[model samples]
Target: MTQALVDGTVIRGHGVASGHASDSPYPAGTIAMQQPYFAALGLDLTGLYLATINLDIQPAQWRLLQADYTFRALRWTDLHPPEDFSFIHCQLLWQAQRYAGYIYYPHPATKIQHFQSPRMLELVLPWIATISYGARARLIYRAEQIQIEPAALL
Candidate 1:
Protein backbone atom coordinates (compact mmCIF):
# COMPACT_ATOMS: atom_id res chain seq x y z
CA MET A 1 0.00 0.00 0.00
CA THR A 2 3.00 2.31 -0.05
CA GLN A 3 3.17 4.97 -2.75
CA ALA A 4 6.45 5.62 -4.56
CA LEU A 5 7.66 9.09 -5.38
CA VAL A 6 10.64 8.31 -7.59
CA ASP A 7 12.25 4.93 -7.93
CA GLY A 8 16.06 4.73 -8.11
CA THR A 9 18.87 2.28 -7.64
CA VAL A 10 21.18 2.49 -4.65
CA ILE A 11 24.77 2.75 -5.78
CA ARG A 12 28.25 3.11 -4.33
CA GLY A 13 29.14 6.67 -3.55
CA HIS A 14 32.49 8.42 -3.83
CA GLY A 15 34.28 7.58 -0.61
CA VAL A 16 36.36 10.68 -0.35
CA ALA A 17 35.75 11.32 3.33
CA SER A 18 34.34 8.09 4.62
CA GLY A 19 32.46 8.20 7.92
CA HIS A 20 33.97 11.48 8.95
CA ALA A 21 30.84 13.43 9.83
CA SER A 22 29.86 11.11 12.66
CA ASP A 23 33.35 11.44 14.07
CA SER A 24 33.67 15.18 13.71
CA PRO A 25 33.31 17.74 16.51
CA TYR A 26 30.44 19.28 14.58
CA PRO A 27 27.89 16.44 14.62
CA ALA A 28 26.63 17.04 18.16
CA GLY A 29 26.46 20.75 17.65
CA THR A 30 24.98 20.31 14.22
CA ILE A 31 22.33 18.00 15.62
CA ALA A 32 21.65 20.48 18.38
CA MET A 33 21.33 23.25 15.84
CA GLN A 34 18.94 21.18 13.73
CA GLN A 35 16.80 20.00 16.66
CA PRO A 36 14.69 23.12 16.90
CA TYR A 37 13.84 23.09 13.23
CA PHE A 38 12.86 19.44 13.40
CA ALA A 39 10.71 20.13 16.44
CA ALA A 40 9.09 23.14 14.79
CA LEU A 41 8.33 21.03 11.75
CA GLY A 42 6.90 18.22 13.94
CA LEU A 43 9.51 15.73 12.78
CA ASP A 44 10.52 12.93 15.11
CA LEU A 45 14.24 12.35 15.45
CA THR A 46 13.95 8.97 17.13
CA GLY A 47 12.92 7.41 13.85
CA LEU A 48 15.64 9.00 11.75
CA TYR A 49 18.41 7.07 10.07
CA LEU A 50 21.79 8.73 10.57
CA ALA A 51 23.33 7.22 7.43
CA THR A 52 22.76 8.49 3.91
CA ILE A 53 21.46 6.72 0.79
CA ASN A 54 23.06 7.77 -2.48
CA LEU A 55 20.56 7.50 -5.32
CA ASP A 56 21.69 7.30 -8.92
CA ILE A 57 19.70 9.80 -10.95
CA GLN A 58 19.52 10.83 -14.59
CA PRO A 59 20.82 14.17 -15.84
CA ALA A 60 17.45 15.05 -17.35
CA GLN A 61 15.72 14.25 -14.08
CA TRP A 62 18.27 16.36 -12.20
CA ARG A 63 17.69 19.23 -14.57
CA LEU A 64 13.93 18.90 -14.21
CA LEU A 65 14.27 19.21 -10.44
CA GLN A 66 16.64 22.15 -10.72
CA ALA A 67 13.89 24.00 -12.60
CA ASP A 68 11.15 23.11 -10.10
CA TYR A 69 12.39 22.48 -6.55
CA THR A 70 12.85 25.30 -4.09
CA PHE A 71 15.69 24.52 -1.71
CA ARG A 72 15.91 26.07 1.78
CA ALA A 73 19.30 27.00 3.15
CA LEU A 74 20.26 25.51 6.54
CA ARG A 75 23.19 27.34 8.11
CA TRP A 76 24.73 25.50 11.07
CA THR A 77 27.77 27.45 12.18
CA ASP A 78 27.76 29.47 15.35
CA LEU A 79 26.09 32.87 14.82
CA HIS A 80 25.93 32.36 11.04
CA PRO A 81 27.43 29.77 8.73
CA PRO A 82 30.13 30.75 6.30
CA GLU A 83 28.97 30.85 2.70
CA ASP A 84 31.05 27.81 1.89
CA PHE A 85 29.50 25.19 4.21
CA SER A 86 25.74 24.93 4.46
CA PHE A 87 22.97 22.38 4.02
CA ILE A 88 19.49 22.36 2.50
CA HIS A 89 16.37 21.04 4.13
CA CYS A 90 13.99 18.66 2.34
CA GLN A 91 11.55 15.88 2.96
CA LEU A 92 12.16 12.29 1.84
CA LEU A 93 9.60 9.52 1.63
CA TRP A 94 10.29 5.79 1.58
CA GLN A 95 7.76 3.00 1.92
CA ALA A 96 5.07 5.63 2.48
CA GLN A 97 6.99 7.04 5.46
CA ARG A 98 8.02 10.67 5.34
CA TYR A 99 11.39 11.65 6.85
CA ALA A 100 12.46 15.20 7.42
CA GLY A 101 16.13 15.66 6.53
CA TYR A 102 18.64 17.62 4.46
CA ILE A 103 20.51 17.45 1.18
CA TYR A 104 24.20 17.91 2.04
CA TYR A 105 26.68 19.09 -0.58
CA PRO A 106 30.27 19.63 0.40
CA HIS A 107 31.68 23.06 0.18
CA PRO A 108 35.43 23.62 0.15
CA ALA A 109 35.33 24.05 3.92
CA THR A 110 33.18 21.01 4.58
CA LYS A 111 34.65 18.06 6.46
CA ILE A 112 33.32 15.58 3.90
CA GLN A 113 34.38 15.98 0.30
CA HIS A 114 32.58 14.59 -2.72
CA PHE A 115 33.99 14.72 -6.24
CA GLN A 116 31.86 12.23 -8.16
CA SER A 117 28.80 14.44 -8.44
CA PRO A 118 27.91 18.06 -7.99
CA ARG A 119 25.28 17.28 -5.38
CA MET A 120 24.39 14.46 -3.04
CA LEU A 121 21.07 13.82 -1.35
CA GLU A 122 21.42 12.68 2.26
CA LEU A 123 18.42 11.28 4.09
CA VAL A 124 18.30 10.51 7.83
CA LEU A 125 15.78 7.76 8.53
CA PRO A 126 15.30 4.83 10.90
CA TRP A 127 15.08 1.94 8.47
CA ILE A 128 18.33 2.15 6.51
CA ALA A 129 18.78 -1.58 7.12
CA THR A 130 15.90 -2.24 4.77
CA ILE A 131 17.95 -1.19 1.74
CA SER A 132 21.36 -2.25 0.46
CA TYR A 133 23.87 -1.55 -2.31
CA GLY A 134 22.42 -2.21 -5.78
CA ALA A 135 18.95 -2.36 -4.23
CA ARG A 136 16.27 -0.34 -5.92
CA ALA A 137 14.47 2.18 -3.73
CA ARG A 138 11.75 4.70 -4.22
CA LEU A 139 12.83 8.25 -3.27
CA ILE A 140 9.80 10.33 -2.52
CA TYR A 141 10.04 14.08 -2.30
CA ARG A 142 7.13 16.37 -1.46
CA ALA A 143 8.30 19.46 -3.32
CA GLU A 144 8.33 18.59 -7.02
CA GLN A 145 7.75 15.65 -9.35
CA ILE A 146 10.84 13.66 -10.37
CA GLN A 147 11.83 10.38 -11.95
CA ILE A 148 15.02 8.40 -11.10
CA GLU A 149 16.18 5.20 -12.73
CA PRO A 150 18.44 2.50 -11.35
CA ALA A 151 22.06 3.33 -12.10
CA ALA A 152 23.65 1.48 -14.99
CA LEU A 153 26.29 -1.00 -13.90
CA LEU A 154 29.81 -0.09 -14.78
Candidate 2:
Protein backbone atom coordinates (compact mmCIF):
# COMPACT_ATOMS: atom_id res chain seq x y z
CA MET A 1 0.00 0.00 0.00
CA THR A 2 1.17 3.49 -0.85
CA GLN A 3 1.50 5.76 2.18
CA ALA A 4 0.25 9.34 2.16
CA LEU A 5 -0.27 12.06 4.73
CA VAL A 6 -2.81 14.73 5.62
CA ASP A 7 -2.86 17.34 8.29
CA GLY A 8 -5.81 17.54 10.67
CA THR A 9 -6.83 18.88 14.05
CA VAL A 10 -7.58 16.85 17.13
CA ILE A 11 -11.11 18.01 17.78
CA ARG A 12 -13.47 17.41 20.64
CA GLY A 13 -16.02 14.83 19.68
CA HIS A 14 -19.31 13.50 20.97
CA GLY A 15 -17.45 11.78 23.82
CA VAL A 16 -19.59 8.75 23.18
CA ALA A 17 -17.06 6.92 21.08
CA SER A 18 -15.41 5.54 24.17
CA GLY A 19 -18.78 4.94 25.84
CA HIS A 20 -17.41 6.63 28.94
CA ALA A 21 -20.30 8.97 29.51
CA SER A 22 -21.99 8.82 32.89
CA ASP A 23 -25.12 7.48 31.26
CA SER A 24 -23.27 5.24 28.86
CA PRO A 25 -24.24 1.62 29.15
CA TYR A 26 -20.88 0.29 28.10
CA PRO A 27 -18.30 0.96 30.79
CA ALA A 28 -15.26 -0.18 28.85
CA GLY A 29 -16.15 2.25 26.05
CA THR A 30 -17.77 1.72 22.65
CA ILE A 31 -14.57 0.58 21.05
CA ALA A 32 -14.33 -2.15 23.61
CA MET A 33 -17.97 -2.95 23.23
CA GLN A 34 -17.55 -3.44 19.51
CA GLN A 35 -14.30 -5.31 19.77
CA PRO A 36 -15.81 -8.75 19.96
CA TYR A 37 -17.95 -8.16 16.92
CA PHE A 38 -15.03 -7.00 14.84
CA ALA A 39 -13.02 -9.90 16.11
CA ALA A 40 -15.75 -12.29 15.08
CA LEU A 41 -15.56 -10.77 11.64
CA GLY A 42 -11.84 -11.49 11.49
CA LEU A 43 -10.59 -8.03 12.46
CA ASP A 44 -8.74 -8.40 15.70
CA LEU A 45 -8.21 -5.13 17.59
CA THR A 46 -6.70 -6.32 20.79
CA GLY A 47 -4.70 -3.88 22.93
CA LEU A 48 -5.94 -0.81 21.08
CA TYR A 49 -7.37 2.01 23.06
CA LEU A 50 -10.94 1.60 24.22
CA ALA A 51 -11.58 5.11 22.88
CA THR A 52 -11.24 6.91 19.59
CA ILE A 53 -9.34 10.06 18.68
CA ASN A 54 -11.50 12.42 16.69
CA LEU A 55 -9.68 14.12 13.84
CA ASP A 56 -11.03 16.88 11.67
CA ILE A 57 -9.50 17.34 8.26
CA GLN A 58 -10.31 20.97 7.62
CA PRO A 59 -10.13 22.70 4.27
CA ALA A 60 -11.11 19.29 3.00
CA GLN A 61 -13.53 16.42 3.30
CA TRP A 62 -12.89 12.68 3.17
CA ARG A 63 -14.72 9.56 2.20
CA LEU A 64 -13.92 5.99 3.09
CA LEU A 65 -14.94 4.62 -0.24
CA GLN A 66 -12.62 1.67 0.17
CA ALA A 67 -10.94 0.18 3.17
CA ASP A 68 -8.68 -2.63 4.24
CA TYR A 69 -11.54 -4.11 6.22
CA THR A 70 -15.26 -3.56 6.08
CA PHE A 71 -17.98 -5.04 8.27
CA ARG A 72 -21.63 -4.71 7.42
CA ALA A 73 -24.86 -5.25 9.30
CA LEU A 74 -23.21 -5.25 12.67
CA ARG A 75 -25.64 -5.39 15.56
CA TRP A 76 -23.08 -4.55 18.18
CA THR A 77 -25.55 -2.68 20.34
CA ASP A 78 -29.07 -3.48 21.38
CA LEU A 79 -30.05 0.15 21.97
CA HIS A 80 -29.74 1.01 18.30
CA PRO A 81 -30.04 -0.66 14.94
CA PRO A 82 -27.24 -2.30 13.04
CA GLU A 83 -24.31 -0.31 11.68
CA ASP A 84 -21.60 -0.65 9.07
CA PHE A 85 -17.96 0.08 9.70
CA SER A 86 -14.77 0.26 7.70
CA PHE A 87 -11.20 0.23 8.86
CA ILE A 88 -8.23 1.57 6.95
CA HIS A 89 -4.57 1.11 7.79
CA CYS A 90 -3.04 4.33 9.11
CA GLN A 91 -0.60 5.86 11.50
CA LEU A 92 -1.14 8.80 13.81
CA LEU A 93 1.68 11.33 13.72
CA TRP A 94 2.22 13.40 16.82
CA GLN A 95 5.31 15.11 18.19
CA ALA A 96 7.47 13.61 15.45
CA GLN A 97 6.41 10.13 16.46
CA ARG A 98 4.28 7.67 14.56
CA TYR A 99 1.79 5.38 16.23
CA ALA A 100 0.10 2.43 14.60
CA GLY A 101 -3.55 3.24 14.03
CA TYR A 102 -6.57 2.80 11.88
CA ILE A 103 -9.00 5.22 10.32
CA TYR A 104 -12.25 4.19 12.02
CA TYR A 105 -15.12 4.75 9.68
CA PRO A 106 -18.52 3.99 11.13
CA HIS A 107 -20.70 4.48 8.11
CA PRO A 108 -23.27 7.20 8.68
CA ALA A 109 -25.65 5.54 6.27
CA THR A 110 -26.13 2.57 8.56
CA LYS A 111 -25.88 4.36 11.85
CA ILE A 112 -29.04 5.24 13.68
CA GLN A 113 -27.36 7.81 15.90
CA HIS A 114 -24.25 9.90 16.50
CA PHE A 115 -23.70 10.93 12.97
CA GLN A 116 -20.22 12.35 12.36
CA SER A 117 -19.21 15.19 10.10
CA PRO A 118 -17.78 14.47 6.68
CA ARG A 119 -14.64 16.32 7.71
CA MET A 120 -14.18 14.05 10.66
CA LEU A 121 -12.60 10.63 11.11
CA GLU A 122 -12.53 8.39 14.16
CA LEU A 123 -9.14 6.83 14.87
CA VAL A 124 -8.19 3.79 16.91
CA LEU A 125 -4.69 3.46 18.29
CA PRO A 126 -2.70 2.36 21.26
CA TRP A 127 -2.50 4.68 24.25
CA ILE A 128 -0.62 7.96 23.76
CA ALA A 129 0.25 10.64 26.29
CA THR A 130 -0.48 14.34 26.69
CA ILE A 131 -2.77 14.59 23.69
CA SER A 132 -5.53 17.15 23.92
CA TYR A 133 -8.24 18.77 21.87
CA GLY A 134 -7.46 21.42 19.24
CA ALA A 135 -3.99 20.00 18.76
CA ARG A 136 -2.78 19.67 15.19
CA ALA A 137 -1.87 16.16 14.05
CA ARG A 138 -0.98 14.30 10.91
CA LEU A 139 -2.45 11.09 9.49
CA ILE A 140 -0.32 8.68 7.50
CA TYR A 141 -2.74 6.50 5.56
CA ARG A 142 -2.82 4.13 2.67
CA ALA A 143 -3.50 6.17 -0.45
CA GLU A 144 -6.08 3.79 -1.86
CA GLN A 145 -8.04 3.31 1.34
CA ILE A 146 -9.33 6.84 1.88
CA GLN A 147 -9.95 9.56 -0.65
CA ILE A 148 -9.36 13.03 0.78
CA GLU A 149 -10.51 15.93 -1.32
CA PRO A 150 -8.32 18.86 -0.35
CA ALA A 151 -10.42 21.41 -2.25
CA ALA A 152 -13.73 20.21 -0.89
CA LEU A 153 -15.53 22.69 1.34
CA LEU A 154 -16.88 21.96 4.80
Per-model TM values vs. the true structure:
0.47, 0.92
The candidate scoring highest on lDDT is: 2
lDDT by candidate, in order shown: 0.46, 0.85
Which window of ten consecutive residues has the lowest lDDT sum in model 2?
145-154
Candidate 1 lDDT trough over 10 residues, lowest sum: 62-71
Q: Write candidate 2's Cα lDDT for 18-117 as tens digits.
A: 8757776677777888989999999888868868999999778887757889998899988888988999989999999888978888888998667888
lDDT of 1 by residue, 20-115 (tens): 354444444444455456455454456554445676554413312321212244454554443232334455555566656554433434333244
Give model 2's TM-score versus the native structure: 0.92
- Any runs in candidate 1 off by more than 4 Å, and if so which? 1-4, 15-46, 59-102, 105-112, 116-120, 144-154
Q: Which residue pairs of candidate 1 clash?
A: 48-125, 49-124, 49-125, 49-126
